[model samples]
Target: MNYELRLYLDQLTAKSASIELNSTYARAIYIVEGSIAIKNGVSTRLTLSQNSALSIPESFSLGGGSADAIMLRWELVNEVDNSNKIQASQSTLLLAAKMALGDLSQYIIRCDRVDFPPEGEALTHRHLGGGIRCLLFGSIQIHTLGNIHTHQPLSAWFEAGPDAVYAATDKTLASAFARVMILPRGLIGGKTSIEYVNSEDKNKPKSQRYQIFIDELIQH
Candidate 1:
């Protein structure tokens, strides 16, 4: 079935505060700033810090931190109408894409961080699945569709799988970005999503480093 995939930035004032979620869709929550405790009906509570993330179907509200807390939420919607359901106090939609999502059992939902040191670059390559990326720090340039686009911290962009692209980070300082991708189930626990365009480029040195936060089977 076709589905709409979305990414949002949510902010909470303090403890006892709450945010609504789509219980029918699978979700990936990443703590962007401050801290929050996750509590559910069964008393299963989990605390997440900066850069931490998890995959869950239910959201019981988030609160508790010295100041306002922020989170990046990825939601998978089975219907187009439910894709834009917004809560008055929830989050701002960063981006959305409609996906055919061929076989629910053959895909996995994942959240990961790609960090690049000063002067780092990701060579021309393509991914196996489509996803969106939101900058975490520093600046980056993405080359695709015969054009180059620059993005700052908090800025977001979408990458359609199979399109060749190259990325370059800030030259004077370090850069990092957090991204969520819908990948093949075969990629579970492994990092084989990127495919360099040139066969000879495969032997070239790489400057980017990866750290995965969550990788789980996608649920319908």
Candidate 2:
């Protein structure tokens, strides 16, 4: 299953564009433009504006009530677990990890949100970690040793295998925030292990999965 990550920005006006939620996948909605209203399955509605986000379950119905608004939505690609409950009515960017997916691996993933004050690249460091990164918030131009790329909202990039060192510089003064999901690359040749190496663990030559779960992750 393929997950969808989207970013809506600078939408001048829209009549009424909405999509119904499917039970197989969950959704996360965030407003970036004008004021908008979202309806689940009940009479109650959720009103969101700039900086506000909403979580929509697959069983719920989501639609727009205003025109010319920018909204972002993330639909989960996996099935639901027995521990999760579907909220018929609500709109927020935050969603439970277990509810979005059946597994607990979603909680093990690390999400890094970076915000630069006035001057960009306040500090630069050599990072020894690699994984799938999704830009959920602001826009950032990342320049690594390999190449330079611009990461906008809802853009995901994956780094296969391990042993990759990279650094990121915030090219925009607006601040750059993104979600990084560590993949489950087994160290001990087990399904539950993850391959991670630090300055201390570099010489060990072993991988550790560490009971990590990736059931749910923030769309960022």
Candidate 3:
């Protein structure tokens, strides 16, 4: 797969401190808390409140608000080709729209609300499909691919193409909650769309999958 996941967080505490975000990949910003003002130096200032999201275009420098705000930013590695050089069928467009809406249909698209108790950890495992997660509260550390990264509240992280083994543990004595969305890279209409790989000592369990309705997300 040519796509990669880039996740980062922005915290604005002081009234004079602003975050400069510039990315070559298409990106999206989700406001985890407080309010943020987004300006691209060309458009009018856009204000986003808690639980709101905004899509940003490639090659843009946007300045975010300067006071007590936490936001999760997500960007994909490859810029999607939007040229109409090759025509696509309606079915193909429908599928693409479904994928964008987080509806994988026959493929796997699961939303999991994961809670890790104090000092809790998950068995080393890998998902055939990649996913993105945002911490709702507390913090968690992820150990994967010879590296360890800790994510704090309102922070977002994601894995790339299949075979990325990782384990997660809470960073504090308090429990941590996260909302995760997992999706398969390629859709398999008839066969199972996702798989799970456990460590050698762990049992091979069936893959647990869930569906996310687009209407439900829109209402929230």
Candidate 4:
């Protein structure tokens, strides 16, 4: 089914301060800073620390339990759910757009981290699916669709799957970003979605690394 993919950067301050996040869409939360306490329904409390990731369906509440915390959330919404718009609760909506997912049964929602060394560059390439990405550290220069932009930490941008893209990392430091992509279910077992435009580029030494966090095939 067609859906709207959304990204939000949520912040929480002070201890015991909680925020309600009620949504019917599937969500993936990555803790960017500090720690948090999550409560599902009337009971069931869980704590997530920095760098931790959690995938949950339906609704729940997440709050900062110690010090302040930061979270990056990715959600997928159905077209028919437009009537019940998401009410942003203490979170900054980074990106939101419709996804041409004709059907989700043959799709897989994946979250992964890509890292490039200093002065590293990704040759011209395209992917099998589209999604939003957020830079975590250092910087990156992305050139695609006749547009170029350099992103800093916390900065986000959308990557079109079929469009060719070329990226370069900061000259002085390593760059990394965390992204959530909706890809074909066939690529579920750690398969890559990138396809280099020039076959010779694939034979060249690669300077980037990948860490897959979530790879769940959509359940009909």
Candidate 5:
């Protein structure tokens, strides 16, 4: 249950603004805007762009581009003994899957950002995996099994299990960034990890389709 969240906005403006980090836990780097270069060791370098993310196993150093950049970084240490005691709300059982998979220790971690336009809403859907979400901008509301919660910027929440409906909290635009780690069963290459109960919405445009929305986030 050891984790750390670091927020850096417009901090990386030059090549000399590099920072070194050493952790025994796994780390995820989220590129909110602009780009950054990460170096783990000699001959290993990664360039992450806007809306994209990457997770590294241990220690590394990262720096930004000539232009200012915004990024959110998370460092998590997996504690098998504490897997069953996940901290989250009553509506979401965010760590249930992790507890189930702890013995096997086989899972994949995926991270991305999702955006909802003003008044935009999505059909009721559920994910096959559990993860944590942090509101980066605007406000968001989540509906799960009769439970509803509104979240504000810089606020974090957990999506427990995979059987909840999430939507925009209000009439305004909102966006959330999340890093999810799930067992292999949750995601198979080229296939969706979400199950939408209402698949056919003739009135909804294809571009606004729930499946399409999630696909774009995963692909990005």
Candidate 6:
């Protein structure tokens, strides 16, 4: 698996600013702030701000305009070594929904770019199963067995030890947030599962549907 995912930040304040491309490489870009016009053979202007992105191909001629903006760039390296893993190409503009975790047949994992508005909470629950969650943005307070575990930005959680029993509190007191990636590792000698239920649903039994839910997650 490729483990070299990166985030780049570029702030542009000039007009008609551009870059050239004549080779082939796969890459993605997000307009974290401001607007820009992109040109390959023709000009395609995109006025983006806050979390918007673009994927670029290495083989095309590239140019663009920037109207006071900042962009986040995500690129996939080493195409020849991982040809089977390549699905999204460079030179394509991508929104939040377009970002994804590709191929899960060989692994048990689910990554989501979640968004929590200000003064919002993710509800109360327990990770009674096994998995890991990497927080790529914002903050969260996790509860495990009625205990408080507050994590700030770039924090992570893992379930690989005997002391993995945990849960979260329902009382939330924060603003906009997101849970970037949640993954279940291959335990050396342990069990693993992921589950979620609509708190609004009353027909399902709590914790009884975790296995089925995890299996269903891999399909997406």
Best by TM-score: 1
Model 1 misses residue 190 by how many Å? 2.0
- Model 3 TM-score is 0.45
Distance (Å) between predicted and true CA of 6, model 2? 6.9
Worst 10 residues of 5 by lDDT: 211-220
Query: Could you list the CA RMSD of all candidates, in the order they appear?
Result: 1.8, 10.5, 11.3, 2.2, 7.6, 10.7
Instruction: List model 1 lDDT by residue over 45-76, tens digit each.
Output: 77888889988866565665555678888887
Please give the lDDT score at residue 144 for candidate 2: 48
Q: After superposition, how far is residue 166 of candidate 2 from its true place, in Å?
A: 4.8
Ranking by TM-score: 1, 4, 5, 2, 3, 6
Q: What are the per-residue Cα lDDT tens digits for candidate 3 across 1-220?
A: 3443444556554353334444533345566677677667677577777666665634443343554676565544433644211122100111111123233232333333455656666555655455577767766777778888887765556654354445455545554433333344354232333343544535543222222221111110
lDDT of 3 at 132: 72
Which is the winner by TM-score between candidate 2 and candidate 3?
2
lDDT of each: 0.83, 0.41, 0.48, 0.83, 0.53, 0.38
Clashes of 2: 20
Q: Could you tell me every candidate's TM-score relative to the true structure? A: 0.93, 0.49, 0.45, 0.90, 0.65, 0.42
Model 1, residue 113: C-alpha shift (Å): 0.3
Candidate 6 residue lDDT tens string, 85-108: 222332222211112334533333
> Total backbone clashes of model 6?
26
lDDT (tens digit, per residue) of candidate 5 on 47-141? 87776777664657777665566665543444432322112320122222232344223444556566666665656777676666666676777
Which runs in model 4 stand beyond 4 Å of their true positions?
A: 41-43, 79-89
